[model samples]
Target: MSEGLSAARQRDLLIATTASAVITDATLLPFFPKLFATAFGVEDPRHVGLYLAATCLTVMLALPVWARLERRWSTLQLLVVGQLGAGGLAIASHLTTELWSFWACTLTMIVFKASYLLVYPYVMRLVPKASHAGVIGLLTVIVHLGGILGATLGGWVLEHHDPRAAYLVMAAGDFLQMGVSVYLLRRGARAPSPEPAHEGVPEVVEASADDPAPALPPIPQRLSPLVRLGLLMAVVYFSAFITRPFFVEYWGTRSSLDGELVSGWVFAIPALASLVALGVQHMGWSRPGSLYKWLALIALGVAIQATPLPAAIVVGRFIYGWAAFRGLVDLDLALFEISPPERYAEDYSHMNLCQQGGVLIAFWIAGLAVNAGGLVQPLWIALGGFVVGAGVFAAYGSRFVAAAPSEGKAPEEVAPC
Candidate 1:
């Protein structure tokens, strides 16, 4: 077997992954509403909400299919094709003279976005098992860094230039990511072999001929622990996003703050929270049972967000963002611990689908709540969901916490890479 990845190769992989992630996040969040508004002649937040629902549906549907395809093709191959498809579709949206074309482009983006899902499993395979949590945490931080940069850069570009220009810049980043992925694959293929495998033996041979070959486990069955962790993560993601649709609606009815300033605060809060997530990574409070601690912090952040003053809301939003990021990091590490190598993509896909499914439900509920009641009502609902999710974890999550391998117990032998 090859000894291990060199530091340079690891760095290159991280850079490439970061570039791809940033571009994907940039395209979706800050720029998408603007793009849809311009291209479709629609400005209602409800329309944007519908588009998000469609995108989420597409991603959820495509993931299982993508996971199956990943079993047949290499990660590098899938990633390159995905990048090119996404970039091309994004550029094509700008060429659309009709609203239908924009819809078509969005649909195509769902297919392209499947590529972004593969990166997590690939990174997990590359890192040492002992360092799984730290590496996963680092990767999550990189992803947030991309999100932070993409949001800031997209905002700046949109202000200084046209919406189409933003897509073009994003497309350029996608193409660059494709190039780096190709290089990585080529370099990997060309590297000299260290040794030869035994002629018939699998890397992780089964113990008995009478034993049936282990079936490729279904996503739900293979990842029960991760599913538990995902339940908690879903709540966090849902809480953060449920109130999003009503931000503009809420501000529109208010008289105290300038409309633009209020909008800025809404966006700025998450961005500030992202920065806090980065800072918290170094603090060493990320072990098991950390979810409950972060949940308490998130509740405090929500309480602060409920305050009447704008300054308190801004600070609270930052805290929410911080807690959200920490929750994600811990949950991701937990997932890595529970997932088996053979089912990595399938397991990760399921976890993501679970999170997105919760997001879809929250968005739909929030939309209805906004139409029925008001903005503040949805925030209160999210707070309740967070509390309930934390309670569930506190009650049932202790069984899965990472622990030292016991005396006289052999380490679980993973299947061959």
Candidate 2:
């Protein structure tokens, strides 16, 4: 609805911010037992899990504060501030040898890095409602690609140099993000301003002609649509992420090939799965209404990965990746489809906080589980999460249908909290 910039400029901004997002994921996703051991000489899975959970906690605490700042500053402006702070803190982390000092610097770095999340909703605002699923699909794929790249790079760094060198890579990524944000801000400033619109009037963007209808029904009038969606996504994310932190370690235990590089490649199986799924999606063969099927596949995949065989683990990763990419994209599509353009940034921030909460809890439990029962335990926990999540989704499905807004009406009108 904002007319300050043209569509071309918006596309350019999305592209630049997306590149930053890829780098951010590449730098951060590699954090876990390997990088933690390298950086702090701490190899205990419990402590490693705790540290990863703490990062999520940092992001959770910081997200709302950054969301509130959007009222006073554009997302690009905030990104510049965030990236500069994050980049500096990342360097500070590299300089520290003490565990607590490094923890302090890295956690504070996450606080600033949290601001870059605004790019998701900000970009969603720039495009038509119809293209939301396509965009979300592409972004999901990028996340997988970043994960693949990060795992490989992190492995190489840990193998060939001081493991702590990963922090320098993180710092470099943050600086590059900062550069992109600054360029966007300057470019926006130089563009001619559009004619002023009426104050206190909200603009409604028409739904795209080809845009699919909302995936599920609306929630009750007492709860907001975004809130309901966020809760549902939280559970789904928890199921998927419970196995994430210890995946490399798990691979190391099962496979005869035991170097960091091989483990990295094994760890990236899901990303490779995402690539195959993306190709399938590109061929227009993916079913839009198969959310339930995707969920079932995910549960089966988790079960398969829990087996003792390394080959089963690799096969399971591909299954999980394919289902997860489709399922997550569908959920995101559902989110934006029901949301009004005016609330994109605010709504997305709220949803992301819920997501972080889920991941936070998962990380905590994974550490404790691995400590108690060894590496294989978390996959079973993840399978249980998927079952619970699917149940919750089914339980809530009817309510959403009952409260769904009529065509062309904003979800707020029907589902306000």
Candidate 3:
């Protein structure tokens, strides 16, 4: 195949990868705490806690591997192999009855699932830079929506059928994605890397014989403000996922709590809230209002969990859904604005690493909190984290935005996450 991505081909990459994003996250959500009993003999929250911790480490370590491999091979190629491998692992984990077998297979699959990290760059390169935020937002929506669908499916399957059935569905979904990736490979033209607007221009300066040529300023190799913003985003994402794994068990234990399936719906409220946030954003809601609004929503969610009331917990989650979506999406857009199109993959890989690090820390805190006080402490931790993140952004965001060379930077595009 020759280079240059077609519009239809970009669409395929987006659909396949977005679905891939959904299945992996969705496949894992409902199996925790509830399903741990059947496979591990101990249904304690600690097991799920430990498992998520392991996922944190596995993906953290594995993401860099994918990033490195992408430098040498095709991202689409890695995605193809990763999907098939992850699919087989999902299916195999379903087959294994042993706890050790399950954990090993599941965690290993996450290592492969790290390939999902590359999809950002995969689609980023496939589309023009101008559309980056829109694509990212749509992908973000699909991802959250996937979480809803996955959790609902997992919960429903567990309620009616065997827990393993959920994995089977995930496996089927993975294979379908793999097929899509393969078709993109076989039929689509090889997408060309972007060339800078001034790439071929000669650096000519008119000078008189008596006038010596002035030395040119060096191109900036490092963007410290952008790096700082990236860190803030990492924290935001970390704060977002900190309490995610425990929602089912957290809400399920309440006296007024409905059932496993209902827990999925409860978990899904944030995604719905996210859609609302996106609509508000699309409608030209004020940009300056982002930081305070984001912090408030996050604080509300955490405070709700802290209340000891189950109904409060539900209310908080909805508030948090909106908070997480807007905060994460805006921060990502900030990064997009600062990034160069040529370094898109490399830059996002670094961003991914930072976000993964935050998630890893979240898991560590989550595991400890679960061990100490059931599941409430992590919310406290996440709340504190959100506070720190919001402060960091508010204090430094304007400076960072000011730091950009207006003419040098890419155009800022707004999209949902």
- List, in order, the clash count of every candidate structure: 0, 3, 3
Which candidate number has the best lDDT?
2
TM-score (C-alpha, index-matched) for candidate 3: 0.85
Per-residue lDDT of candidate 2, residues 1-417 (tens digit) = 245657557656666556655755564464567666766678898897888889988988898889889878888888889989988998898788899898899899989999988888777766666687778878888788877888788778778877667778888888887887776676673222222334654445557989996666554656666667777778888888889888877877888887877787877888889988989879988656556668778998999998889899889988998888888987888767665666666667777878888999899999999999998999999998888767666655634322324334544632211
The TM-score, computed over Cα atoms with residue i paired to residue i, of candidate 1 is 0.79
For each candidate in the order shown, give its overall lDDT on alpha carbons.
0.64, 0.76, 0.71
| Residue 53 displacement (Å), model 1 | 1.1
Runs with alpha carbons beyond 4 Å of true place in candidate 2: 1-6, 27-31, 189-221, 395-417
Error of 3 at 289 (Å): 2.6
Global lDDT of model 2: 0.76
Local error of candidate 3 at residue 265 (angstroms)? 0.6
Better of 2 and 3 by TM-score: 2
lDDT of 3: 0.71
